[model samples]
Target chain A: MQFPSLEYLIFFPLAVAAWYAAAPRLRWAVLIGAGAAFLALASPTHFAFAFVLSLVNYFAGLALERWAETRKALWVLLATLAFDVGVLGLFKYGNAVLAGFAQLEALFGVAAPPRVLSLVLPLGISYYSFQLIGYLLEVYWGRQPAARHLGHFAATILFFPKLVAGPIERPHHFLAQLAAPKPFDPADVTAGLKLLGWGLFKKCVIADRIAFVIGPIFGHPRDFSGLPLAAAIALYTVQVYCDFSGYTDVALGSARVLGLELAPNFNHPFSARSVTDFWRRWHISLSSWTNDYIYRPLSMVISFHTSWRRVGTVFSILVTFGVLGLWHGATWNFVLFGLLHGAAVSVEALTSRARTRLLGRLPARVADRLNNVVTVVFYSLSCVLFRANSISDALYILGHAFVGIGHAAPIGAKRMFGRQYHILLLGLVFGALVLGRWWTRRRPVAARPTWQRWPVYYAVIAAIVILGLFQVNQFVYVQF
Target chain B: MTPEAILLEVNKVFAEVFGNPSITVGPTTTAKDVPEWDSLNHTALIAAVEKHFQIKFSLREVMRFQNVGDMCALVRAKTGG
Candidate 1:
């Protein structure tokens, strides 16, 4: 169910209540049942898909553990990984491949093939598949033991909170929490509620409001001129951050309320001063996963072939990010998005020493501001590919972004904030952005004195109530 | 093959790979402890160590090293010290 919907509003409280009411030993059963119910409620097809994959991976993990240190274990690991990737490919890319084949047939004047079985993408397939693949690899490499309990293993893959869109919990971290579920703590509950509220405010107030303006400009980029286009791109950058990170906050907070800890995903990414630093902070879990599983191993292999280590590192970064981009979807634009980032990161790595030397010559504050501006502009421009309808469209917009600067009319804020409250809303958004940066720099808000924190909390709640769109817009990351 | 002996070689590799002659690493030193020891430089350091010590590390072995101490232990074990 969508996070902001009435159904989820009712379902979450009931699920939480039932979970706590159960005996500690049976809590796992409660979680498993709840997860199954959620999947079934969402889609029986998704429920079947998740269940089958979980069962397959469960046995695969055991077999890998049983045959560890043998050639058989290697085969088991490869087989399980293939199955996971195969399932993901068939469900996620099956339609895209079909469409591509149709275009090829038209080009060659060949008869089209008959219709294939239509596939519905199982929710969380990309995320859970990666989790299972990581689990199998860990077991094969003897990094972590295969989970003995089938229920816990299934729960790890199908846990409802993070299943939809993830911080992509690793086996080592997530399984440990499942092994010993904690009892309800009042402080945990309070902290979780605060985080949940903040996340909701970000989603409903900031992201959804921004989407109203972003939709038209990006949808018809040819119609708008320089400033409006730039504003759309910049707003899109903020909107995506709020939407995805807002989802993560709610997921983490909900898990915390249940006394489980999910891995953190975002880390104030906009504060990053360089492209490399941006990757370090943004979508932290996914980047780390790719770093460990894809980039590091690929770099090692590349190192065997190349004498110049920098070339190998740069090549590996590009390939790894290319794959990461493809992970977003089976689209050419996504591929470009990933490659752009890859190139940017490679440049940053290659020029680190030179950049450091240059920065050393400047004042610290000047250097910091310059770096931040460069990073932000580079990333915002790259996101043009991410948000555009096609690569050509993205290029057109990028080509025109700075063309008519200072000559165009201000992109009015009426559609985004309503005619009466445009100025007020704009001021609030700007204020929130500034305060968000300052707040993140401090300790966790939950840890602050109530006298200091309550006012901020109430203000956020009030803002959300006054300005929230309350539309059922799925988070941008969910499609991935 | 002793930890101390391996660490001396490791320290040299670190200095050469990172281009900092003053650099020194002990058993407990981690990546975070060194300013220049980022992901790109890390692979180079591993390669330099392997070439110097005449021991190749498995991918898992390379990934599992948490600190210089772990690397020293692996080197010692592989060299049959």
Candidate 2:
């Protein structure tokens, strides 16, 4: 179920209450049962698929642990990884591959075969599969022991809060939390409520409201040009950040109420001074995962073969990011999005020494501001590729973005905002975001006095009630 | 090689690899402690250390080092100092 829906609102509190009321030793059973019920409420078929995969992975971990340091262990590890990746590939890309094959056949003047199967994507399949794969690999690499309790292992994979759009929990961290007992604390509850409110405001008010403007523009970029198109692109950057990060915040807040800590996903990514810094801050869990599993090993092998470390570093970064891009979707736009980021990062790495020297010549504040602006502009432009329906559509918008910079839009302000109040509301929300960032940079909101904190909390709730779209749009990252 | 001697060599390696002659790592110094010691430089740093110490580290071993102290301990164990 969607996080913002009424059903989830009722279901989550009940689940939490039931969980806390259960005996400490029986909590895992309560959690597992709740997780199953949650998944069933969404999709029973997906629930069944996830259950079977969990069983397979659990056994795989056991087998690997038992056969450690032997060739048998190697085979088990390879087999498990292959099976997990194969399942993911089949479900995620099978249709795209088949359609491509049919198109190729048509290009050669041959009749294509009829469609074989209509596959429905299982919810959270991509996320849970990667978590399980990471667990299995950790066991294989001797980094962590195989989980002895099946219920605990299952709970880690099926934890309802992070199961959908994940901070993709690692076994070393998440499993240990599952094993520990979580006693309720008033402080944690208050913090969780505050965080949840903030997330809701960001999603329902900022993101969804902004979507009203950009939705039409992105849907028909060909009809627009100049400043409006640029504004749409820039607003999209804000919308996506608010949407995804809002989801993460809600997930984290929900977990925190139960005294569980989920990893932080975003770290003020827009403020990053470079593309490399942006990756480090944005989607931290996934970036670190790819870095450890894909980039490091590839770099090791390449560095071994050649003394030209720069070439190896550049190549590894490009390939790793290219894979990251493809992970989003099978579309060529996604591929270009990934390649563009990869190229940017590669360039940053190669020119690090020169950039450092050049920046050293300028004042630190000026250098930081310059880099931040450049990074923000670069990311905003790159996001056009991500948001566009096709590569050609993206190019068309980019080509016409500067066509009439100072000209008044053909569409009037009343049409754009629907009312003058919306313009005021949008301005206020945008100002609050900037002010909130500045305020937090000076002193964390949480560290403030309760009298001060309560006003902020109530204000956020007020914003959600007054300004929120309340349409319960699906979180942006759930599609991946 | 003594622990002191290995630390001296490691200091030199860190300084050269990070391009900062003033870098002097202590036992608890980690990747977070050095601005230049990012992932790209990390592999190069490890390779440089392996070459200097004339020892090979398994990938697992390489991944396990949490700080300069851990690296020193591993070097000592491998070199039988």
Model 1 alpha-carbon drift over 4 Å, by segment: A113-117, A305-308, A406-424, A432-452
Go through the candidates in order and give each one's C-alpha lDDT. 0.83, 0.85
Candidate 1: what lDDT? 0.83
Task: List, for all models, the DockQ compared with the true complex.
Answer: 0.60, 0.48
Q: What does candidate 2's lDDT look like per residue over A1-480, in tens digits? A: 778878779988987898788877677777777778878998798888888899999999999999988899989989989998888888888888888888888999999675645887788887888888888878887778999999888887888888778888886687788788678788887788777888888899988877876776777777677887888888889989999999898989988887888888999998899999999999888887778777887887777666878889999999889888887877888888888999999999889999999899999999999999999999989999998988889998888887867333455332455544654788888899799889889788888998987787788888888889875468888888
Docking class of 2: acceptable
How far off is residue A478 in model 1, in Å? 0.9
The TM-scores of all predictions, comma-separated, are: 0.93, 0.94
Model 1, residue A40: C-alpha shift (Å): 1.6
Cand. 2 TM to true fold: 0.94
lDDT of 1 by residue, A1-480 (tens): 777667778878888898789887667677778788877888888878888998999899899889877889888888888899999999888888888888888899988775565877899888888888877877776778889988888888888888889988896687788777788899888888778887888898888877765676677777666777777788888888899999999889888888889999988788789988899899888888888788887898777666868889999999989988999999999999999899999998899889899899999999998998999889888989998999988997898878767223334333333533643585678887788769868686657898977887898888778877775578888889
